[model samples]
Target: MASAAEQLAANMNFQAFAKATELHKRIWFTLIAMVVYRLGCFIPIPGIDIAAFSQAFQGQAGGILGMFNMFSGGAVERMAVFALNVMPYISASIIVQLLGSIYPPWEKLRKEGGEAGRKQLNQYTRYLTVVLALFQSFGIAVSLSSSPGIVDNPGPFFIISTVVILTGGTMFLMWLGEQITSRGVGNGVSLIIFAGIVAVLPRYVIQAFELTRTGGMNGGVLFMIVVLAVAVTVAIVFMERSQRRLLVQYPKRQVGNRMFGGDTSFLPLKINTSGVIPPIFASSLLLLPATVMGFAASGNLPAWAESWLPGMVGQLQHGQPLFMVLYGALIVFFCFFYTSVVFNPEDTAENLRKYGGFLPGIRPGKRTAEYLDYVLTRLTVIGAAYIAAVCLLPEALIGFAGVQFYLGGTSILIVVSVTMDTVTQIQSHLLAHQYEGLIKKSKLRGGRGR
Candidate 1:
């Protein structure tokens, strides 16, 4: 049987959506912002030779450059102004967070400075973003200048111009993301990436169909691909929603003349406590050097960069042994590190103690904290393996199937997680709207009875 709230939610219809004025505005704003972003993807940067860039894109489409192009909504292929996207911001954010964990002063500021501290940290991230963009843009500019026919006029002037244009584009995207988050709905940065990935999905579907029609792809093969994709999506949805709930009991209490307090509840510790953040952070880190190298050398490595250690960035190629090992390692590392950053067992334990709540059969404070940490560590191990497997399998398929699709493991996670989050927000808005209407009706009835 469904609960009353569940029943009410199910009963909601399009009429209720129409009545939700605020939600309507948010939806429109989000749509408009995304449109604006997509438009920028078509606007070329000042000095790119579009013909040469297009040709170059075809050869390097399977490399890291292809991944960048996918995330940029094909902006990189066009050498569009928004080609850099908000990747620098993401990379900078990762660096800042890593620093916060390791550096005492930064950690103290985050722990003690409250909301103001967070603002300060954001400011630091923006500064770092600019620095990173400058370096990356310069690398890209130089790489383009060195490559024949890639740059319209290969010189200092063109290099300077490219750097300035690319850096400014990334900064603009950063601001636009903040705007969407504050004025619209869902996470702005993730939505931007989501939009980029989804925009090219139709083309992939068409490509698959064309191959089938031409007898290049067998009908059975196409069906298998569809089945695999659906199965992966279902698995992702299940993993994203799975949680480990610990029972928490509050003691019965009497307050003066009234009786109160004996209620049991659950403290839901998610299987993936960091949500989609770990993959995004790990991808950003892995891609940072790859992006620089792609633009700096365009897959033809200089001797210095080619000197191989185990898992060198220059040696990275999807489905290769070194690439798979490095990718899995980074995913696991970020999963544990990010989970620790976002959730503290100690803090949870302290909060529970303050509220007179305790886990069943466990003592409060230190012992509870220890138990929570133990459970979380075990969960994290499972979560890390799950994320790595999900991510690696798709990339491996790229090499095995010989398909040119760019629906990466990380991209799928972001798209699904963001969609789920946005849908939840919309549902919450609708439920709130229904409650407001009921209140107004009750007030009118009371006035008539008066």
Candidate 2:
């Protein structure tokens, strides 16, 4: 049976994908959804003065807003209705996940119920997104209006309008993401972000050339950067795919009258089980305060407040020592935090014991749980360090290289991880299709032989 399955997979080809009508439809639907997302990013919000807003962003592009703008695919810079993107939703989801670890009610909901609980949690996340979106939009609007020469006049009406519009835009984006997830191939949120990042590539390239023309960057540095980027991308791919396999042995057991069971399997744990969450969480937390500070600096504030606040803000700015330290620490913290949230050794051990599975050299209950936990702790440390290096090294290099582009660690990790997952899904679909074809062929051959 295994040999036949292998033969089926070996024969799988592009023609199978073409013949699979449902897969084709799914692919097309995903493409259309992405196009819709891109279109939303181009639609400007009602209140913003485009010319003035553009100028303001141009100056503040090196700040926290710059990072946000990149994530939104230049929507923030263009003052688009979807300028906030789905980040508030992501932030809300992360917050809920974190809280679920500590809060008993949330923890119970997570462990006890299945689909119903998940749906309830999702509903809560959406509510949190709406609230966060409103707050952030209000803050952004107030800040934009406060910026000198950016707005014609600042008033309660304008602030209220901006907040409402931005919040509505975010909700719309959230809905769009859900549609993509239900109908599309990859994750809707990640694809939206991926689209945004890809959209700005041409601009980043153009800017790089402009820098070269202006002698801001030399050809040697440019070559080095390209090489490093490629190498880092390769490393990300490798680490993301790497896994540790824990061998599990099942003892023979008699059920009714027959013997059923001496079998072996393996528990696979990914090296970077947390994926891109750690870096993203770290970035969001680090950027929040800097964003607030940048906005405050735009406003007319007391001199004393401005003097002290700017120093505090400066510490959190990208490329600064304090920023790097905080970012690294946050990444490590989230690595462990997210890992624990996702993987429970006790639960795993329980499931294994229920299935009559045990680690080759370990006992089946508490000892098995403890062994798994010990291994996971060591693995988490390695995973955290790997994440930190991948994320921080690029930023450090980009800082030293003085590149004008905003390619950061989080963006690269997302692109790599999502791409890998999508590819694996595609391959699995193809393999299944191939096996079905093989089974049909084998049946036909058997009938002829009879």
- lDDT string for model 2 (105-126, tens) is 9988888868888898899999
Taking all chains together, each candidate's TM-score versus the true structure is: 0.92, 0.93
Over 4 Å off, model 1:
1-8, 212-221, 294-315, 438-450
The CA lDDT of each predicted structure is: 0.83, 0.82
Evaluate model 2: give its TM-score: 0.93
When summed lDDT is taken over every stretch of 10 residues in candidate 1, the lowest stretch is: 306-315
Give candidate 2 regions above 4 Å deviation: 1-5, 255-258, 435-450
Estimate, for each residue in 302-412, the C-alpha lDDT of model 1 and write its tens digit.
677656522354356565566677778988998999899889999999999999999999999999999999999999998898888878887787667766555567777
**Going through the candidates in order, what is the number of backbone clashes in each?**
0, 0
Which structure among the candidates has the greatest lDDT?
A: 1
Looking at model 2, the pairs that clash are: none
Give the distance in Å from residue 216's predicted Cα in candidate 1 to where it truly belongs.
5.0
- Give the 10-residue window scoring lowest on summed lDDT in candidate 2: 312-321
Score candidate 1 by TM-score against the native. 0.92
- Index of the highest-TM-score prediction: 2
